[model samples]
Each structure stands twice: as structure tokens, then as C-alpha cells.
Target: MGENSSPPDPVRSFSRLAVIVQLMMLAVVSAGWAISDGTAVAAAGTATAATAAVASVTTPPMGWASWNTFAAQINYNVIKAQTDAMVSSGMKDAGYQYVNIDEGWWQGTRDSAGNITVDTAEWPGGMKAIADYIHSKGLKAGIYTDAGRDGCGYYYPTGRPAAPGSGSEGHYDQDFLQFSRWGFDFVKVDWCGGNAEGLNSRNAYQAISDAITRASAQTGRPMVLSVCNWGNQSPWDWAPSMSTMWRTSGDIIYWGQSASMDRVLANFDSAQHPAAQSPGHYNDPDMLIVGMTGFSAAQNRTHMSLWALSGAPLLAGNKLTDMSADTKAILTNREVLAIDQDPLGGQGVKVAEDQTGRQVYSKVLSGTGRRAVLLLNRTTSAASITARWSDLGLTGSATVRNPWTGTDAGTFSGGYTTTVPAREAVLLTVTSGGGTSSPSPTPTPTPTASGTGAIRGVGSGRCLDVSGSSQANGAQAQIWDCNGQANQQWTSTASGELRVYGGKCLDVNNAGTADGTSVIIWDCNGQANQQWRLNSDGTITAVGANKCLDVPNNATANGTKLAIWSCNGGSNQRWTRS
Candidate 1:
């Protein structure tokens, strides 16, 4: 009996079949999306020509950068060592692609004709040689530069002396073109010099973006642009059109030290502009500080889970050449990584928080009624936390699986409850919540109507009014005292615009789709950006971007501006029409 096999178990066979079917469905759906966009996708399977050059960018980038650990001490030998270790240490196979040489790689050196030059001493075989080496290892190469005339190597200068004009201030096009010519696949433009010179963030980054575009065109290779302005000027509001990712906050950990949990939480909070994120665009929370010296194993787990939940770029900042087995295991956990790289590109939001420092967070996954839940306990004592189905927009019972330990935690009705250890977290994926889910508590189809009414905010108890009651085309929408005025009156038109003043439609300023895009009144032109849908969930959604009308920071003050953000079931997004 030990060596002989009986008939296959029906349950096991069914489970295997289900897995296969799910994988097939995913491949089919993903491919359809990419093909519809006229782009090549790996899931398409047959378009080997287009698929190879332009794989669908549906997730935040995952890679390793040198700044947090090696800082300005990096050189040709240093990069080679890390690049080799990235492959040998299993990081390369784990979807860690870019080996970024952040800052310090170059000093202010330009030859005749205003060309940026890398010192042969530091970059021995030239910058292109290292890029070729990284590509040889089947990974992408990332280079760094400052927006103005100085960089960290010139100001903060770690292990190197200050070198004037170490940035790309006067050479945006030339510098980016040089990076592309040298085979760099990514570029992180820092704001050190820009800030020093009081340069306008928008103007400066826009120039860099344009330069990168020109470079990509010239080289026939697109480079991922990382706008590293540290969230100043709220890059989430406009950077999506220019860069793949923008830093939402300052560095999680300094160049040479371990990061604190508070810093992690702060950075996480800063990057929660969920409305701004989409496929190929992300709000960066700086690089990962996992496995660093200061954090304990539990803390490390929490850090990873939070970042993964936020759909942040999973850039490793630890020295890969020497990592403990535990660190490697935590870093290489595929289940957690899958959440970070979910194809849907949804950001997790805080659904509930308590007095004892406990919180429940939820993220809507790709499949029906599937959700990712995080039970975080920030208190010093262990606490039992519950994830409510109502809060998650889920109904009835659901199956829960712990991604960290790879085990099913059974099913429960209404919600799931578990005791999270102090200062740690529990990450579980909930699926197949019994019955159906509604975007709201009661399912009501958005009816087509010509009726006019004053729209009030559920959270702020204020009326949505045109700022200053201005009739100008770009007048901003804001929450003000409820008054039966024409400015507060809105008609939900059949064509989807919430029209006021008869001819002006609520528009996304300049038809912007990024997070924090202002909600304003503009001349009705029947554009998708001006279209609105009054949903059953009590939220007004911008049809084109599929974002909700939201009060910035949930402010209850009068004159609080309104914007469109990714719907997160927040009261700030709920509105009432009467």
C-alpha cells in the first residue's frame, strides 16, 4: 500500500482543476486588455514580436537601489558585485529587475560641447559597460541624476567630496539622452539642486519628462522615469502623465541607517493618494528598508505588508551579498509579492481604526468578491481586530487565507476576526464572500434624470457649490454652507454631466485624470472628463477616470476644495442629492 497508489481523490482533482481554470482565465483576460490597448503582453503568448519590447506595465516596479545602503560609495566594482549577488541570491528570479545606481555614480564633469562625462576612474570601463553587465545578468539598469546643477554627491556627499554642477540642470535633454544611449532602462531625477535653486517643481519635472521622451525617441528604447521630488507640490496631482513613479515622501531610511516604524507609517500615509495611482503609474514611498539593522523580524514583516498593501514599488535597500536565511525568506515570499504586483493596480485604504491603535485595511482584488485584508496592531499589547464585511463592501461569509504562512484560515460570516500580535500585522486574502456585493449598502442603479437638486456632502454636511459662485468656466467646486442657490443646484443629465448654469458641466480641470485633479465647472463639450455618474453608493464618479468626487483630506471646513480620487468608500466621497 505504501508504494501503490489508489484512485485519485475527487476533492484534490477538483482543486487542481480549479487552479488551472483560474490561471487560464487570468491569462485570457489580461491578454485581452493589453491587446485592446494595442500593446504587447506576455499573457498574449503568440505576439512574440511586440510582446518582447512592450510588456504590459500593470504593477509597481520591483528592484534594488544603492542609495539606502551603499550611498555614494558605489563604483563599477560595487555595482558589479551587487548585480552578481542579485542573480545568485535569488532576487533576480523573484522579479527584482532594476539594479539602480542612485546618486554618487557621477560627479560634475562635462567635456567640450556641454556633454556629461562619467569619470573613467569610478566607472572604469565606462557607464555603458556596467549597464551591459546588468543586462547580461537579465536585469535592467537604473541611473540617477539631480534636476538642478547639484546632486547628493555634491551636497550630502557620502564617502565623496562635493563636485559642483553634478546635476543635469542645463542638460536635461542631453543628460537623459546620454543615459538612454548608455543603455539605462530607468532614471531617478532627484530634487536636491532644484530645491536649492527654488525651481518650480512642475516646470522642472515637466522639462525632464519631455527630455526623457525625446531621449526615448532618439534611442528607440523607453526609459522608466522616476520623479523624486519627495512629494513637494503633490506630484500625485500631475506627474502620472510624465513619469512611471513619483516619490510621495522623504526617504524611509536615511542613506546609512536603519528606519523606524514611525517613519514607515508616515511614509505610508503620505503615499495614500489612492486616486492618483493606475496601471504603469505609481506613488512611490521611497525604497524598502526591510531586513535593515534597526527593525526586528516582526517589524520587518509589518513593513513589508504595509508597503505591499499600498501597492508600492518593492525596491530592496539591503546589502544582498550577505543576507541571513530569515531575511531572504521574508524578501522572497511570493505570496506577499503577488499582492504587491496585483494586475488590477488598486491601492489599499484604511477602512477602520480604533482607539487602541488597531486598524483594518482593505484592498479590492481583481476577482469578484475577492479582497485583501490587513489587521494591524500598533499598540504595545496584543489586540483582537475584526475586518467587517460592510467596511470591505463585502457581504456574508468568506474564505480567508494567510498569505504569509500559506494556509487557509477557514471561513466566517459578516467578517473575520483575529488577534494580531502587538506592533505587528496579519495579512489575509478573503475570497468568495457569500452572496453578492454592492458598491453601497443598498443596491440602487444610477437613474438617468433631468431633475435638478442641491448636492450635499455626507461627511461635511455642506453643499457642493461653485467657488465664489463664479460663472467662469474654470471655477472650482467646493463644500460650503448649504444654500438654495443656483451654484449649488445641479442637473444629472442623460449624457452624464452634472450641469450647472445650464451650459457648464462639472469638469476635471484641463481634463486631468491624476489624483487631486480639481473638480470645476467648464463649458459643456461632451468630453469624458466632464461626464459624471451619480452612483447608488452616494458617490459622484468622474466617468472617464472612474474616480469619486472627494473632499481633500476629508476636511469639514467651508471652502474645502473638491477633487476626484479613487473610490475608497470614505464618507468624504459620499454625497446626497435633493
Candidate 2:
């Protein structure tokens, strides 16, 4: 075998943000608390600013991590074995990259220059060799480290190990740079013991993120930086610009483990619902323990389905050397995996949540032709979960196919239902009829005395006002006279595209597909680039650009340049229903 073809060495241990406190904080501090002095008030204001100021950038990562199943028992050889299985088993071809080895791979001491190194005992040929193996197989290698000195002691959270380098930026930066040198493509930085001891846990997390971003720039390799802060401050709000994926929760374990599938489901709910996550950055609910000792193949299938539908990262935390054919099949399901790795990078949102406790996550996948929905049974008993055509907001007729079973879900009139096993999941792949496009029913333009049909603000009263115009293909959609133009009418279609009246489609102005780009109305060319959806929170996101439509200058002025910007819920980006 060639030098780069050598198998990686073997065993080690490993370890691994968001919401609510923010609202309470704003209410209590800004509205309730009053600082008596100017200096004190300024300090309070500054502290109120969060580190994760950006909106959710990427959808959750969709691949595997090693912590949940192997824990500290992971080794270099194990990563090699898993990467091989991932390829031979068809996972890499299906887009499951990021073969991350969690904790224990790092040495307890740094070099005199403050560079972190891999333990030679566990990784004899060095992380570079392991990375070579992974890359040779067409995959990415991820490493584990801590933002704090002594590694944050997260290896055993409750029984802190007194990690010597706990909360050390110098050490953290050194480790990141070293990983970059070793050809590592991803980093999962932990914050266990450092959470309580940092000058401010939030600031400390930001500091590490800044360090990683700098390292990524310095090394000239685009590494995925994942901050595992366990939802202390709202990572959804702050970490998107710095990292690719950040853990929204501590870790998810099933089959009598510390964290159960229930915890995983809850985290999924939080990420999809009122809170939003998007591409470039993701809401990592931790690694997958599916196909591990405790869960059945069916349960694991459901686990994988939910994560994929939610765009959560797919990290397999099982013993790969002993994986069964059924387990391998579940992990490498391409149709299901497509939902997770969809290029659009739009995170699925929760459309239904009932007290009977079932949840549905619907995502818009590629092909300009399909939709993916994961229906999960949160309860321990079997329950019937249905997807109605109306509920999905489909304009005309459609078909739902089971991606997992490879069978037509059997069309009913409006929707379809299947009994989901307790804690299990089902995957639905929806496509429009006959591959032909259908025009949604355009509302009749309600004209005023002036005869100008202007529709203002979509959804909330924030809409465009039109005066005296008929809907046409190239008609100028100006800031109207505000009588509600049906041409100004829009709907979030089942395909997840925000289709407008007439045949035009929403687009990112100039087609500059970068994070934080703005949006505009463009000719519909049946291309994914023209599709867009206004997220429930009123942020407008375009499909082709993979970014949110932003109001430039934060200006609400008429003809304000609508550009594609990152999906942060700022007043500049947040839209209201007209």
C-alpha cells in the first residue's frame, strides 16, 4: 500500500447551546432592572450583548460523530475502521462526511511552543496519517479538543478531571493550528469544566470560536468548527459566523444511556420550531448512538430519519467493526441522507405538534422536485401521524412516497397517515404530479377607488402596496398603492418554495450566493435558484443562494435594496405579514 494508504491506528475516549434565557434576560434586565449610574448601565448593556450574534447559519450537520457510542473508548484504528465501513457501506457516496474522533486523542501536555499533539500510543502515525486515510477514502477527518485549559474535563463531566489546560486560548489555538496541519477538516471544541470557571462562559466560548476561525484562515483549510457548549448562552444567535456546527445540547444517548432518544427529540423540537437554524452553521444535537447495543434497527432508522429531516449532523457513535448489515443499511440510506445533506441548507420546521405528542419536520430537498418529511412519535405508544395536503400547504395535487420503504405511501385525497412506533420515525418523500408545474390560484387583485392593486407586507401588515395594475409576466412590481395585489400574493408551497402570483419567483438579487446576501423578485426559470420560503419567524430565505433576504442598511425605506444576507432575525431581516 502507498504511504497515504496505510490504515489509521486504534482506541480513545471523547466528549461533547440555545434559547429562552434570552427572552427572560431581556425582560428582566432591559425592562425591569435599572442601573443607577451611567458606567454601570453601559457595563450592563455590553454584557447583555451575546457572543453568538449571528443567526443559525447552517442546518444541523448530517454525518457521524464518535462520542455517543464509543465515548472515551475511541481509538485511531477505530476511526479508520469506521471510515472504511462508511465507504464500503456507501455512506461517503451518500454524503455522510466528517468522520470525527472525539476526546482522548489529545495528549495531556502541550509542546514548549504551546502546540497540542495527538497521543502517539493511540495514533502512532499521527493525526495527519489518519486524516490522509479519511481523505483518501473521500471523507473528512474531525478532531476533538477543549476551549478551556486541561481540556475542560468533559471526558467525565460530573467527576471533573482537573484538566490542566482548562480555559486556555493559547492551548486551544495551538491545538486548532496543529489539527489544521494534520489535514483535519473539522473540530468539536468542548466546554465542560470551563463553563463555570471562565471569565464569562459566553465570552470564553466566543474566544475559542474566534481562535478557531483565525486558525482556519491561517491554515487555509476550510475546517468545520463545532462548539460543544451544551446550550448555555444562545449559540443559535452567536456562533454561526465562527463555526460550522455547534452542539445545541450536551449529548444524545439511547438504550439506557445517560441521554435518551426523548432528549434527542426534544432538542430537535427546539431547533426546528420557534427557534431557527440554517446552513453554514448548524444546530448539532450531538452524535448518533443508533445501531448501537440498545436500539433496534427500526428505532435506529427512525432516529436517523428525524435527524436527517431536521438537518441535524449524522455522527455514528456505534462500534463500526461489529456493525450488522441491517445497521449499515440504515446508516447508508441515500434517499434519506439526501434530506440531511440538501444543498439548500434550509433546516426543516415543525408543522405539527400535538399533546398526543407526535411531531413532523418538513424540509425542502434538491431536484426542484421533492420534499422530505420526518414524522416522529415522541410518546412511548404507537400513534397515527398524518400529513394533510392542506397542512403541508400544497396548492394542487401531489404524491407522497416512503423513502425508507421505497413504496408509494398510497395517495389519499388530502393527506396520508401511518402508525409510527413508540419513539420511532417515518420518512416521506413528496413530489409534485407528473413533473409538470402547476400555477397556484392567484387571488383576484382587490382594487381600491384609485384602481391600483397594491399588496403590502406579506403575512403581517408589512407588505407592498400596489395601485392600478394587472398581473403580467414582466410587469413592474413596484412599491404599490397598497390595495393588495394578488400578483403581490405569495404562498409557502409544499415544495417549500415561496411561489408568488403570476409566474415570477423570488430570488437573491444579483444571484450572489453568499451568506448574508439579500433577495429580489426574478423571472421563474424552473431553477432551484428562484425558489424561496419565508420561515415562520418571517425571515425570507432563497433556495439557490442558501441565504436569507436582508433589507440593506436595515432600512425599511421604499425600494430598500433587498439583498441576500445571513439568516439573523434582525429588524433589517425580520419581515411581518401584510
**Model 1, global lDDT:** 0.75
Report the Cα lDDT for candidate 2: 0.55
Candidate 1 on 1-578: residue-level lDDT in tens? Answer: 00000111122222223223333434454554567655534331122232222222557888899888887889999999999988998988888999999888888888998887888988878999999999999999999999989876776877789878999998998998999999999889998888678787879988988887777778887888888987655676667756778886667777556668756765675576565665566778889888888988778889999888888888898888898777887888899998888886667766655432577777666777787788877667999998777666667788999998999999888778899998688888888646434332222233322245688889999989999978687899999999876678775533355666544568888777789999888755546787676666687778777788899999999999899999998999998876
Number of the top lDDT candidate: 1
Candidate 2 residues 459-512, lDDT tens each?
233454222333233333334324443445443322233334322345545556
List clash counts for every candidate, in order. Answer: 1, 87
Off by over 4 Å in 1: 1-56, 354-356, 433-436, 439-578
Q: Every model's Cα RMSD, please?
A: 14.3, 20.5
TM-score of 1: 0.69
lDDT of 2 at 474: 33
Name the 10 consecutive residues with the lowest summed lDDT in model 2. 1-10
Q: Which ten residues in a row have the lowest lDDT in candidate 1?
A: 1-10
